[model samples]
Each structure stands twice: as C-alpha cells, then as structure tokens.
Target: MKKYDLLIKNGVVVTTTDMYACDVAVKDGKIAAMELNMDEAEAEKVCDVNGKLVLPGALDVHTHLQMPFGGTVSADSYLSGTRAAACGGVTTIFDYPVQHAGETILGLVNSKKEILEQDACVDYAMHCCITNLNDGEILEEMEQAVAEGITSFKCFLVYKKEGMMVDDATLARLLIRAKELGAMINVHAENPDLIDLNIEKFLKEGKTSAWYHYLSRPEFVEAEADKRAVHWAKHLDAPLYIVHMADKEGLEACIEAKRQGAEVYVETCPQYLEFTCDVYKREDGRNFVCSPPIKGQESQDALWQAIKAGLIDTVATDHCPFQSYEKDWGKDDFTKIPNGCAGVENLYPYMLDAANTGKISFQRVVALCATTPAKIFGCDNKGSLVVGKDADIVIYDKDKDFTITLDSMHSDYDHTIWEGKQLHGYPVQTYLRGQLVYDNGEFVGKPGMGQYIKRSPKK
Candidate 1:
C-alpha cells in the first residue's frame, strides 16, 4: 500500500510569512508532509506541478447565495456559488443566513444548513444575521447559536427600511453579549437616516440615476457609522468586524481604533480595491451597484495602502449578484435595482494578478485571501499549508495570460463586472481536502461534496 494518498512536487510553496521550494504530501484528506524532496514512490498518485505556485485555498468570509433581496433572489444557488468559488481557488465560504422578525437564530441556521449541505461544492460556515431583537430574546439565542458552532453574528446598521437595521441600543447590547459569549459581531456600517435623507432628496430632484446610488451614501454616511461602531466595540471591550469597508474616513476610523488597541477588524472587497465611482458613470453602471458603493480614487488608494501596512485584515468578495435584467429594474431608479455584483470567481485571480504584477507580494496574497480570514473567523483547519491541516490547495500559473468574460465565468449570471479585464496569472487547479474539485478550467466536483464547517468561538 502507498504510504501517502497524493504527492505534489516541484513547485514553490507559499504561506502567510514565507515561500520556498517544497514538495507537499497528502493522505486521508490532510497534509501528510512537506519537505524539499519527497519520494514519488511513496504516494498513490503524484502530480508534478513544475513551474507553478502552490498556495493555500482562500476563504471568502462574506457571500450571499440563493438569497432573496430587492424583490428577487440572487442569481447563484449554493451549488453554482461554490462552483464559482472552486474555480477561483476558494475552498471555503462563509454565508450569511438572515433571521427575519419572528424567527429564531438557530432555526434560520438549521434551515440554511439543510440547503447548503445538499448543494454546496465547497466547505462552508455561516455568520448568522440577527435582524429582530424580539425584546432581547433574539440576543438570548446568541449563546445557543455559538454553542451550535455559528460563532459569528452579523447586524446591519443601515437598511432600516428593509427591517434589517439594528438600533444603537440593540447594537450595544449585541456587542456586550458577544463579548461575554466569545463571539464576534460583524456590522454593515452605514447611517440609515443619512442614506434615507439623501435618497429622498435625490429622488425629489430627479437625480435618480445609478450615479445617485454612489451619491446617496456619501463618505460621511459610512464614516460616521464606522466611527460609532468602533467606539461601541472599544468601550464595550468587544470584537467588531466591519464588512466591505469602502470609504477613506471609515478606514481611518478603523486605523485609529486599532491603534488604541480595540479588537476592530476591517474587510474590503476587490471592487473597492480595483474600481472607483467612475464605474457608476458608465452606461453599464447598473452592474456595479452594491452596498457601500465603490468610492473615490482617494478611498481606493487608502485601501491599498492599508493592505500593505497590515491594517486591513482580509479581502473578501461580498459575492451577492443579480442578473442583468434584475438590475435593469432600477436603471432609471437606483432604489429598485438589486444591490450586488459578481466577484467570487474573480476574487483570487484579481488579487493574484496584482501580486504577479508587483502590486503586492505573493505572501501578502495568501494572508489576505486565506490565512487571516481563517484566523479571524476561527476556521482552524484551513488557511495554511502545514502538517495535519486540511489539504485545500491551489496550483497557479503565474505567467499565464487570461481575460475575464461572461463565458469564462462559472457563476449563473449573464453579465460580469470584470468582463474584458486581463490577468497575468490564474488558478489552473483547485483541490479540496486532497480531492481534485476543479482542474484545467472545469469543475469536476459534485454538489454535496462540501461539508459544513463547525467554527470555534473567538474567545
């Protein structure tokens, strides 16, 4: 019998802090060993990844698949979403299950698990969304939720009109409760009142184009709320994770909070890092509509600087996408458009391209895309290549020339915001737990191959 299940040879292995030539061996779905020269005769199968870069699979901590929003559901289902993730070298995803009023947190989680377990193509965890306080009963369920391995919770400080926003008192209560429970609170930081006022003003003045989507929530609208959330988490001595951080002021608030030793983490998306409000000026601008709409050039620059400075914790794609027809609903009126865009299949490649072009080091790419997210969200088995860790890996062709297009994507969407964008590198193969899921531009994994990950608490 072979001593190992699989052996990968002749590649440069990269981790969060280091990169060097190494051969990786795997057995029983875990990394068995890593050494400079491993005997190929010892393995059941051998893959010689000559001239490739072997990196840990990425963990996208934010995504919305098969979710209902803006009068229609997102285009990608769990299977399609994870397939897109697999194709992009993402081995795991953290989905948000929204708890509407009159629903229990555990109930929503169980229901989502049932669906995901049947269709997911990659491992997944959930960050439960608590939209209804239920007179503190919802907050009471957090302990049970944590016990069930749903260790992180999400709260929207905006979207009050949609009934998703949690009041300041409720947020404070959640921060304190999460602190005691050793859980993390994730917030969508935007001042609802400010957004509503601007929307109303813009509509009355007939400035309701896609550009107004960016105009409605100016920098202050997001910055003020970011500052407020930081203050609450700091004072309450709790861990706070701000999602899709887009504006300069919001980033500055997080930087200051971190400087003062607050457990505040910042996450931004590829859209914010690559594009600015100018996309809103394009005729196809509707495709770029998303919450915390891509900000100005100055804000984009600030985000890149923070990433290099280590202030930004992770880069996740808030991969909630709507079809082009659904987005057209708000073409003349920004309010009616489904608010999301496709990015799961592009997240790793875009970042990898940045690294290949000397925009950032390859090691930083692994940290932002894999290691840091796994650390922050308590995905202990993932994030790095080490002995005894799950063998979720990606083989990248750093010199390959590729272009993004609708036909090249794996998600079930008719349009892509990254269409025509070129990249110097791409993931040629993806492995999940030592099993090949995607290879040579094809998804070879089946639905339900993914297992639900039970995450640990942050405390």
Candidate 2:
C-alpha cells in the first residue's frame, strides 16, 4: 500500500529559518518527511515542482471580512475572504471578531465559528475584539476567551466616536490581566486626541476631501500612542503586538522598548511600504482610504528599512475592503467612507514583488508572512516546512511576470487598492492540510471544508 498521500519534488523548500532543495511527503494532512529525495512510488500523487519556490503558505494575522463599519459592511464575506486568501498563497488567517455592547466574548467566538462553519474555504482563527471595556461581564469573558484558545485580544486605542476605544486605565488593566492569563494583547495604536483635533482643524478650513484623512492622522498621532502602548506593556512586563503601524516614529518606539528587553512586536502593511499619501490625489482615491492612512515617501523608506533590519516582525493586511460605489459614500466626507483596503488577496504578491525587486530577501518573506505570525500567535503546526506541521504550502513561479488587476483577483470587492500594479512572481498552486485548494486562476476548495484552529498559549 502507498504510505503517503502526496509528494512534491525538485522544489526549493523555504522557511524563515532554513531552506533545502528537497522532496516533501504529506500523509494524513501533515508533513510526514522532507529530504533531498523521497521515493515517488510511495505517494498516491506527485507534483514535480522543479525550478519552483515552495514556501509555507502565508498566514495573515489581521483581516476584516464582511465587518460593519461607518454605515456599511466590508465587501468580502468570510468564505469569499478565505477564498481570496487561498488564491493569494495564504493558507490561514487570524480574522478579527466584533463584540457588540455587553455581548460575551465567548459568545462572539462561538458565533464567529458558526458563521465560518458554513462559509469558510480555508483554515480560520480570530482575535477577540473588545468594544466595551466598561462592561464587567465582557471583561470576564476576555479571560474565558483566552482559556478557549483565542489567546490574542485586540482593542482600539482610537475610534472613540464609534465606541471602540478603550481608555488608558482600561488598557492598563487589560494588559496586566492578559499577562496573568497567558494571553497576548494587540492594539490599534492611534491617538484619538491627535486625530480628532486634526480632523477639527481640517474641517474648520473646509478640507473635507480624502486627502484630509491623511492630514488628520499625522505620524505624531501614531508615534505618541505607540510609545504609550509600549510603556503599558513594559509596566506589566507583558508581550504586545501593535497592528498596522504607519510611520517611523511608532516603530522606533518598538525598537527602543525591545532594546530595554520588552517583548514588543510591530506589524506594517504593504500599503505603507509600497504606496504613499500621494495616492489620495487620484480620482478613485477613496478606495485606498484606510486608518492610519498611508504615509509619505520618507515614512515608506523608513518602514522598508525597518522590515529589512528585522525591526518589524510580521506583515499583515489590515484588509477591510469596500466596493467602488460603497467608497463613494465618503465622497462628500472622507470620514464617512469606511476605513479599510482590499489587501488579503494581494498580501503575498506585494511582498513577493519586494523580494523580486531586491528590497527584501525571499527568506524574509517567509518570516514576515508565515513563520513569525504562527510563532507569535502560537500556531505550532502551521508555519514551517518541516515534519509534523500542517501541509499548507505554496508552489510559486518565482520568475513569472503578471499584472495585478480586478479581473485576475478572487476578492468579492469589485475594486482593488492595488489595481494595475505589475509584479513578478506569483503562487501557482496552494495546498491546505494536504489538499490542493487553489490552482492558478481557479478555486477548487468547498465551503465548510475549512476548520477552526485553536491556538496554544504562548504566554
């Protein structure tokens, strides 16, 4: 009888820590072995991926699909988002779950899983999001969520008007308690005072265009909040992960704290690295509208250096996209336009383009997109190209050239923030737990085929 379910040979197996020219065998949905050569006769199916780059499938640690915000829902549903993720070389995602006022975090977790159970097309997990820190019941539920293996919880430091911001005292308590409960805390680090004040300043002079969105949330707003969050983490001696950091100042805070021996990790999106605030000048610029709006060329250069120097840990898509018409809602006022970009679908290729352009090493791509997220989030079986990990892999055509466009994408959203961007290298095949789910331009995975993954505590 054949011992292995599938074999992939003649590919360069790459990971954050190691690379080997080897053949890998997958059996029962887990990597069984990898070596320079494995007998093809022992496998039921074999793919000769000669001259290809085999990488651990990318894992996006942040995404918002079909989420309600600013009077409309994000365009991608859970299934559509995961499907898009698969086509983009992503195998797993840590999506954010919204907790309504006074709703139990555990209830939100169960309900989200129920929603994913019907529609998800790839493996899914989530970070518990706290909207009301004052509710004692919700506060207790945070501990229960950690026990249930949703080990990371996020609360925004801004969005006061939307009722999502947690006060400084509340943040301190959450940080202190999370450290005790063996959970990690993530924050949307933007100073509300700075942003709100700037918004008033802009509107006072009749500056209501999308460009003002960038003006209101200046780099100082991010820097100030990042320093505050880091000190809170330092005070509790707890681990912190700040999401979608937009400027150099905030990142420097993380670097300083790390030098002081704190466990401070920061993530930045490709939007920040690849584009500038100048994008808002375009006619359809509202499609690119997002929180901590993409900064300038100087910030972009600093961020790229931070990533290359290993100061930045993971690269995630704060992927909350709206349709073209939906974005028009904010045409009268940029604030009314929902804050997000369609990016989970382009996350891998953007970074892959960086590698091809010599801005980052190929190994750094695996680290930023896969291994580090799995490690920091405690997905023990999801990030490495080694024995016993889940066989989530991407077969990439390293030299293939393609242009990114809506016609070529799988996202439910009609417009892409990255429309018309040209790139080299793209994933040709994606495997999830030993099953081929996406193959160039086609999605073969079925709804409900994805399973909910419970994380082990890394605290």
Candidate 3:
C-alpha cells in the first residue's frame, strides 16, 4: 500500500518563516506531512517539481463580485471572479455582501446566498455590510450573524447620498455590538463630509478631469477619517480593520494605533502601488479610475515601505471591475465613474515579480499573500503547509518570465491597467481542498465545488 494518497517532491517549500526543499504529502484533503527527500516509490501519485516554489494557496480577504454601483453592475460575478482568482493562484476569497438602501440586513444575506447558489469556483466567505441600519433591530441581526459564523461586518463612512454611509453614533453602536460579540469591524474609511465638500468645490471650478478625481479626495481627507475611526474604535474597545490604506498619513495612523495597543489591521491593493493620480489623466485613464482614488507617487512609495516594515498586513485586490462600455459611466463627470478595477487575476503575478526583483523576500511574499490573510480572516486550517492545514497549495515556477497581456488573462474586461508590465513568476498549477482546479491555464474543476465557508469569529 502507498504511504500517502499524493506526494509533491523536490520543490522549494515556503511558509510564513522558512523556505526550503521538501516533499509534501496529502491525504483526505489535509496536509499529512512535510518531508525532505521522501522516496517517491512510497506514494500513489507523485509530481516531480524540481525547480518550482511550493507555497500555501493565497487568500484574498477583500473583493467585490457582481457588485451594483454607479447605476450598473461590476462585470465579474462570483463564478467569474473566483475563476480569475484561481487562475492567479488564489484558493480562497472573502467577498462582501452588499446592501442596498432600504433593505434589511437579513434580506441582503439571503439575497447573496441565492446569487451564490448557482456558481462559485473557489471557496468563499462573506463580510456583511451594514446598510439600512435600523433602530437596534439590525443590531440583533448582526448578533445572530455572529452566531452563524459570519465573523466580520463592513460599514462605510462615505456615499452620503446613497444612504450607505453610517453616521458616527450609528457606527459607535454597531462597533459596540460587534465588539461584544467578538467579531471584527471592517471600515471603508474615507471622510464623507470632506469628500462631499471637495467634490462641490472642484465641480464648481470645472475641474472634472480624471486627474481631478484624486485631487477631489485628497490624502488629508483619508488621514483625518482614519484617525477618527481609530479613536472611535479605541473608545468602544472594538477591534477595527481599515480597508485599503491609501497614504502616508493613513499608514502612520494605523501603525501608531497598533503601538498604542489597538487592534487595527490594514490592507492595500495593487492599483495603489502600480498606478497613481497620473493614471486618471491618461487618454484611457477613465478605465482605471477607482474611489478613494490612487494617491500620488510619494504615497505609493510610502505604502511599499509600510508593507516591508510590517505595518500593512494584506495585499488584496479591491477588484471591482466595469466593462469597457462602462468606462464612460463617468463621462463629462469624474465622480460618476464606478470606483474599481479588476486585479484578482493579476495580484499574484505582480507580487511574485516584486519578489523576483528583490523588492520583497520569498518568505515575506508568502506571509503577505497567504498566511496573514488566513489568520486575520479566521480561516481555520487554510493558510500554511503544516501537517493539519488544508491542502490549498500552488506550484509556481520561479524561473519563468512573462509579460502581462490582455490576451492571456481570463477576466471579462476588455483592457488591462497593467498593459506591457513584466512578471517573472506565476502559478503552473493551483489546488483547492486537494483537488486541481487550474492547471496550465486550463480549468479542471466545475462550478459549485466552491462552497460558502462559514468562518468562525475572531480569536
């Protein structure tokens, strides 16, 4: 009899702290052992990955799929979005459950469940957004949701006209409830009043160009709001997570809060690092516009520094993509452009390229892309190559080099913001729950294998 169900041999294994040559054994969808120089004759199925890098599957904790915004829907649905994620080496994704105005929190959850029933290509979880927050009635729903294994709740501080933004008092109440329930509060931390004030000023000045988009939501706006949210969270003794940390001031605030013993976590997206305010000014810049607009180059460099210093925790794609026809959704008006771009398919390539170029070490790369996100999101048995962890893994050829092109991508968008960019490493195969899902740019699994995972509350 074979000693293991499957064996992967002669690869450079990566974990949060170590990188070495080893063989991994998997049985019944779990990692049974990690050995060095194991004999391949003892395994039922063996893959010789002599020069590849084997790492835990990445977990993208923030993404929006089939999202409705700017009077239209984002082009990628749950099925398409997870498929893109897998092709890029991601094995699990945590997407947000959007709430429209005047809908109950439970109604939104039920609706999202129905939408996800038909197609989901990778394992998924949802962070509920608090919209239509009612007089403590919705608070009960949040409490019940905690019991149901939904660990995080997202609340926005912007979008005043859409009724999605929660005022300070309401936020305080929600935070108190979540804190009591041992759940984490995820915040969209742009200052609503500041953004609205600047929007009026810029529109009156006829500064509606794409460059003006970043100008309208200045760094001070984000910094001021993040500081406020941190203080409020501290006051309520709530664990706070700020999504998409955008500038030097925002990163500084988060770091300082952590030093002062506040439970504040941060995530940054690829657009913030790769593109900038200049992106919005290009002839095709409209296609790259996103809210909490990408900051200046100085802010971009600061974000990279923060990542290396360990202040920023995760690199997620705030992947909300609109079709090419939707580019003009904000035509003649910068504020109306749907605020997102697709990178779920491009995140791993960009990060691996960064690693190959000596921008970040291999161990740090694995930490940022996989381990930390799993820990933060309370994904049990999903982030590392330990004996008991899930068999979510990726085999990447570190020596392979390729340039990103729209023709090679699986996303539905017509163009790429990363056009002409070069990358050195990419996944040759991806596995989820011990099953091959993507191999050599081909999908080997069907929809619905990706099921809704009910995550536990934070530790």
Candidate 4:
C-alpha cells in the first residue's frame, strides 16, 4: 500500500511562526508527515513545488456570500464564492447566516448548511447574525448554536433602517450571554444615529454623490461605536470582535481597550488597507460603496502599522459584491447603492503581494490571514501546515506577477474594485484537504466538495 496519498516536495514551508524548506506528505485528507527530505516512491502522487512557498490556505472569516442586502442579493452564491476563494488560495470561509425576524439561529444555520452542501466548493463554517432578538428566544438559541459549532454571533450597530441594527441594550445582552455560552460576539461598529444625521444633512444639502458615503460615516462615527462596544465588553468582561475595522480612531479605541485588559479582537478588510476614500472620488466611486466606507490615507497607514504591531488580529475580505448596475442605483443618491465589493478572489494575493514587496513579513501574512483567524474563530483543524492538521495548503510562486482583472477572477461579479492593480505574488496551486481545488489560474474543484466545519468554542 502507498504510504501517502500525495507528496509535495522541494518547497519552502511557511507557518505562522516559522519558515523552512521541507517536503510534506498527505494521507486521508490530512497532513501525514513533513521531512527535510522524503522518498517520492512511497506516495501515490508526487507534486514537485520546487522554489515555491508552501503555506496554509487562508481563511476568510468575514464573508457575506448569497446575502440579501439593499433590495438585491450579493452576486456570488456559495459555489461561485467558494470557487473564487479557492482560486485565491483560501480553503475555508466563515460565512454569515443572518437570522431574520421569523427564523431561529439553528434554522438559519441549517438552511445555510443545506445550500452550502449543495454549492460550496471549499470548507466552510458560519457566524450567525442575530437581527431579531425575538424577546430573548434568539438568545436562548445561541447556546444551541454554539453547541452545534457555530461559536460566534454577529450584530450590527448601524443599519437601523434595514432592521439589522441592534440597540445598546441588545448589544450588552448579547455580550453577556455570549460570554456565558463561551461564544464570541462580533460587531459591525458604526454609530447609526450619527450616520443617519450625516446622511440627512448630505441629502438635504444635495451632497448625494459617492463621496457622501464616506462623508456620512466619518472616522468618529465608527470610533464612537467602537469605543462604546469596547466599553460594554470591558464592563461585562466579555470577548468582543470588531469586524471590518477601518479608521484610525477606531483602531486606537481597540488598542486602548486591549491595554485595559479587554478581550478585543480587531479585523480589517483589504479594501481599508489598500484603498482610501480617494477611490470614491473616481467616476466609478459608487462601486466602492460599502458600509464603514473606505477612510482617508491616514487611516489606511494606521491599519498597516496596526498589522505590523500585531494589534490587528485578522484580515478578512468582507467578500460581498453586487453587480455594477446595483451600484448604479445610488449613482445620484449614495443611500440607494448596495454596499460591498468583490474581494474573496483578491484577499490572499493582495496580502501575499504585500509580503513579497517587503511591506510585511511572510510569517505575518500567514498569521493574519490564516493562523489567527482559525485560532480566534475555533477552527481547530485549520490554520497551519503542521503534521496531522488538515492539508489545506497553498503553493505560491513569489516571483509570479499577476494583474487584478475581472476576466482572471472566478467570482460572479462583472467588475472588481481591484481591477488593474498589480500583484507581485500569486498562489500557483491550492489544496483543500489533500485535494487540489485550484491549480495554475483555474478552479479545478467542483461544487459540493466542501464539508461543513463544526468549530469549537472560543478560548
């Protein structure tokens, strides 16, 4: 019998803490062994990844695939989104399953699981969003959800008009309850009152361009809500995860919260790290419209510094995209635009490009994009190239140069915010549990290959 199902040889293996040249062997969909040198004759298949970087496949923990928002659904279904994710070297995604007024947490998760089982091309977990507290009935279901491996719940502090926003009392209740349930509370921190006021002011004054999207949710608007959430988390002694953190003030608030011994995790997306509000000044500004609109250059620089300092826990692409025509709805009024942009296909490449260009170390990229997310979100079998872990790996050619374009992407979206950008490094091959899902610029995986991951409780 073959000692291993596959062997990956002559590659520089990178993990969160170390990098070294080694050969990896996989069996039964998990990493079987790693040696400085391994005999190829023992494996059924041998892939020589000479001179490439062997790293853990990234985890995008903040994605909104097939989500309904702003009267239209996100462009990518689970199949398309996970395929895009695979091509970008992501093997697992923590998608949001939002709970509406008439649904239970488990119901939403079950429904999403059914869809994922049919369409998901990569492994996945879900973070349940509680839009309707349901008079504490939903809170009761959280324990069951956590027991079912959905260990994190999301709440929005903004979007009051959309019926997604949770009041301060609700946020506090969730924090306290999540702590007791050994689950984590993820929040979209933006002050809705201030944002509404700004929007009202902008519309009344005829300032309705895409730039107003940025203007309406200025830095303080996000910072205030961030600080408030931190305050509650600290007061209640609960863990709080701030998603899509975008501004300098908000980052500072999180930093201070950490200093005060609050259990706070900060996540920022690629859009905030790469582009600033200047993109909103372009003719296609509406395409850049997303909640917590891209901030100024100062905020962008601060996010990088935070990542360098290890203040930022994880970098996820809030991979939610709408068609360009959907964005055009808000062409004259920013409020009419559907929020979010295409990003799952760009997350790993963009981060790897930063590492290859010396903006950050390769080790840091692995930590931010893979290890930390898995650790924080309770995916025990993921996040590393360690022996015995799932062999979710990416073989990257650091010397390969790729340009961002819609044609090269696998998402359902027709346009990309990253269009025309150049990436210094790209993933040449991706493996999900010892199986090649993406190879040489094409998605070779099929739908329904992905298995649902039942995550552990937050530690």
Record all residue pairs in model 1 with backbone atoms less than 3 Å apart, i.e. clashing.
none
Per-residue C-alpha lDDT of model 1 across residues 196-257, encoded as one tens digit per residue? 99999999999978999999997889999999999999998999999999999989999998
Per-model TM values vs. the true structure: 0.99, 0.98, 0.97, 0.99
The TM-score of candidate 3 is 0.97
Model 4: per-residue lDDT, tens digit, 356-433?
999999999999999999999899999999898999999999999999899999999989999999999899999999
Clashing pairs in 3: none
The residue ranges of model 3 lying beyond 4 angstroms of the native Cα positions read 1-3
Q: With candidate 3 superimposed using the best TM-score fit, by how many Å does residue 355's alpha carbon deviate from the native? A: 1.2
TM-score of 4: 0.99
What's the distance in Å from true for residue 250, model 3?
Answer: 1.4
How much lDDT does candidate 4 score? 0.93
- Mind giving the per-residue lDDT tens digits that candidate 2 earns over 1-459? 799999999999887766679998999999998987788999999999996989998999999987988888999999899999999989998889877686778887888899899988889889988877645676676677777779998979999988889898888878887888878899999999888898888888888889889888978888899999998999889999999988888888899999999999999998998789998878877878999899988888889888999989999999899888889988878877889998897999889888878988889999999999999998888988889999999998888898989999998888887878998998899999999999987998898878888888874
Cα lDDT computed for each candidate against the true fold: 0.93, 0.88, 0.84, 0.93
> The CA-based lDDT of model 1 is what?
0.93
Tens digit per residue, CA lDDT, model 3, 197-237 = 88899999988877777887889888888898999998788
Instruction: Compare candidates 2 and 3 on lDDT and give the better one.
Output: 2
